[model samples]
Target chain A: MEISELKITIVGLGLIGGSFSMALRELKPKKLWAVDINQDVLKMAETQGIIDRGFLKPNIPLKNSDVVIISLYPEQTVNFIKNNLNNFKRGAVITDTTGIKDKILTEINNFIRDDLEFIGGHPMAGKEAMGFEFASAEIFKGANYILTPTDKNKEENIKLIEKIVMGIGCKNLIKISPKKHDEIIAYTSQMPHILALALVNSNHIDGLGLFVGDSFRAITRVANINARLWAELLIKNKDNILGQIKSFEDSLINIKKSVMEMDSDGLRRIFEKGSDMRDILWRL
Target chain B: MEISELKITIVGLGLIGGSFSMALRELKPKKLWAVDINQDVLKMAETQGIIDRGFLKPNIPLKNSDVVIISLYPEQTVNFIKNNLNNFKRGAVITDTTGIKDKILTEINNFIRDDLEFIGGHPMAGKEAMGFEFASAEIFKGANYILTPTDKNKEENIKLIEKIVMGIGCKNLIKISPKKHDEIIAYTSQMPHILALALVNSNHIDGLGLFVGDSFRAITRVANINARLWAELLIKNKDNILGQIKSFEDSLINIKKSVMEMDSDGLRRIFEKGSDMRDILWRL
Candidate 1:
């Protein structure tokens, strides 16, 4: 089906969901509906003309949506899918914006109907803010969108999701396995969040504000995170995150030992390696 | 003496020295001189009118200036001061842009002439890039300027340095002891640099570039660092930095354990603490 002719519904009107609706509005879908527990948020999105309609419950929208994008916390997403299994239209293409995918996909696979298509997706873009009020379409601009397709997904449905991703100004569309996605995300996303949080919680002298440099500010930008949401993501991907953390601890210990022994050459070599790696990653 | 009536010479025309020259240009001192071993950098500064004159050696400029700002590696700054003990004019106010302070100040104190005042100063500002070519007066704009003054420094000399710091567009002037500066700096500056480098060097899945996000990018921005300079800074402030590293490891291990145990409430509480700390730090 053509994008403009398809009816779409976004579940949960938070930062990611609201942003999805705003970006999808530009595509001019036949109908753009939002399902959120907060009635005030529904009123706000509709008043702003970001969606054709807003539903406090998922049943009505789920029954009519040709495509449903569930943007909720990890566990909430799984439960939402389970509770609404009987409500979705036949052959409807469904996707989710969950951070961890392997377990989520496995759980859905056990109960999902044969006629429906469920694609796992993660858009690697967000602000440290929360809720529908702070959402903006610009967050997805030039973002990397990862789509994890299993055998249950049809080629045409994946193509349709790609069209929507591109319509929202995503620059890269990475297709990978669910397990691969979780492992890579543990390193790139979850580990960094943990480091930032730990750095902020570390002990420091009084009046730390007076001595902070650009490096401190940059490293701690994401320290003001969404605790509830991140707790769910981090715990759900525990093993992979633990592996990444151990690797990070090894690197940190090596550098710390060089400093303790006053090993200038060793410290210099490690720093040089870090610089070269960052340069290569950025250039790619 | 008034800032406009003072003759100022800046040693080492690297990023900090070049930027010092540019920001001081706005003050219009009696004479702005730069000293560097690299004759090409000296010629370029002179040609660009950022300095009234440039010297390949410090002998001539050091003998005449009322104020001298040494912007060099921590060890190099100490050696230059020790070697040029007799060259500085009587009662000249000298300062440095070194990252570490306690050791540098102590070494200079052993041989510094009582007739000449050497007040320790560190402009808490820099970019990942190095060298005179990347310097800009704007780097100091609204940045924090730290002054570590001992009994050897006269009240008027400290005030004079404050005037220059303000003239260079610094927003805050921090006055503390050299020992305190090093301790605080270990947390705010050196430790963050180590973490960034360690994070970049950590193991990750191949094709990691496709999964990069803002959190990773912000956390690793300082990974592309100045190896020689950072190694010197990290080792010179080794004891304090090691203390900070231990503190950070404790925090990280606590958070990691919560994830391993699947303690959702424990994870949320820790994240809340981090978020609160960050918000409070930034607000202050």
Candidate 2:
């Protein structure tokens, strides 16, 4: 299916949804629809010419949409998919932009319409800002887009999704199992947030300005996080996130032991290993 | 007391020394001297007009230098001062640029140079790249320069050091006790390095390229660190760094328990505290 010929409906107007809308706008889809519970956001997006149509509530036109992309908090995304499963087109594709995938995917796949295809996706790009006002299409350029598709998913539907991802300027499309995606992202994404929050909580945070440097700023940049959204993410992916936090704490303990014992060899080994990992990332 | 009239000698032409030289060059000192064991570096700096004179060894002219800045590694800086205490001119303002200060200051202050004054400084700025080639004066522009001065130091000498700091483009000159400096820096600087290293060491790091995101990159950016330099720093500040690492691990454990027990309220509290800290920092 050609990207330009498809009818697309975005079911949120937050940062991810709004940015995705702007990125997809360049393709000039057959009919681009923007849906949000807030009438002001719908009107703003329409005034900005970000979409060809705006809907305050899911209605008949959405049922005939070729693709429906739900961009909401993890739990809200699952609820939206569950509540609107019957309204989706018979052969249309439905996808999501949620960070935690395992629980959301399992719940949505359990009772989703057999006539419709539901694929899980995560555009691994974001800024510290939120809302449609801060959205930019440039965030997706050359960013990694992880797709979690079960074996039951049709190859044509996966290919169509990949085509759309490429059209939106995401050059890296990685296909992995839902469980594998959750496990790796637990380490790469959620562990860093946990560490940042912990570091922030460790200090008298108010007086940190006088003593901080670039290293401190870089490590804690994500500390100014969306608390409600992250709380939902933590609860949904509790098992995997808990495992990562455990491993990370163990690593921190080992480093602390080395420092306390003045074990230069142990400390050096940890640094070398860490540097090796960072070197690989730097090369990439 | 004037910066332009001071005859300055800079030892160890590494990144810190080279950048200090570049920043001081704009002041057009009376006679700028560069000292390094690597004659090639000395020659390069001389050819580039970064220094008026270059020396392969710390000779009598260094002893006569009115102001001598030692930009060597922490251990090397202490050793050099200990070995050449008698050779320094009486009342010469001697200083060092080392990250970990308590041990360095103690050893230097224990020496027999009654007339010479030794002050410890840490310029809170650096780049991953090293050597004189990558040096830039802009690294010190508006950078925080922490000075650790004991009670024995004269007020006039402290003012002189501040003048040099200003001459080098460092607008932030913070006067702090050595112990207080170490305690705060252990949290602000060393803790971040420990966290980044531990995060990098948590996974099969070599295979992390495909699954990583911006948060991972930002958190582990310092993971591409100088192993030997950091090993020395961690060991020297072990007691303080160990305390910080313990507190950080405890914070991580708390967040982990919240996630494992599905305590959303507890998790939200942690996030709110962290965001509060980040907000304070952001305001700075």
Q: Which number leads on DockQ?
A: 1
Fraction of native contacts in model 1?
0.86
Every model's DockQ: 0.80, 0.69
RMSD of each predicted structure: 1.8, 2.0
Off by over 4 Å in 2: A205-207, B205-207
Docking class of 2: medium
lDDT of 2 by residue, A180-204 (tens): 8888888888888889999988874
Model 1 lDDT tens row, A183-226: 98998778777988998899667877677667788888888888
What fnat does each of the candidate structures reach?
Answer: 0.86, 0.81
lDDT of 2 at B54: 87
Q: What is the lDDT of residue A55 in candidate 2?
A: 93
Which ranges in model 1 have alpha carbons more than 4 Å from their true place? none
Tens digit of per-residue lDDT, candidate 2, span B106-216: 877888478889988999888997789889999999889989989878999989989989778887899888988888889888888889988878774335557767888
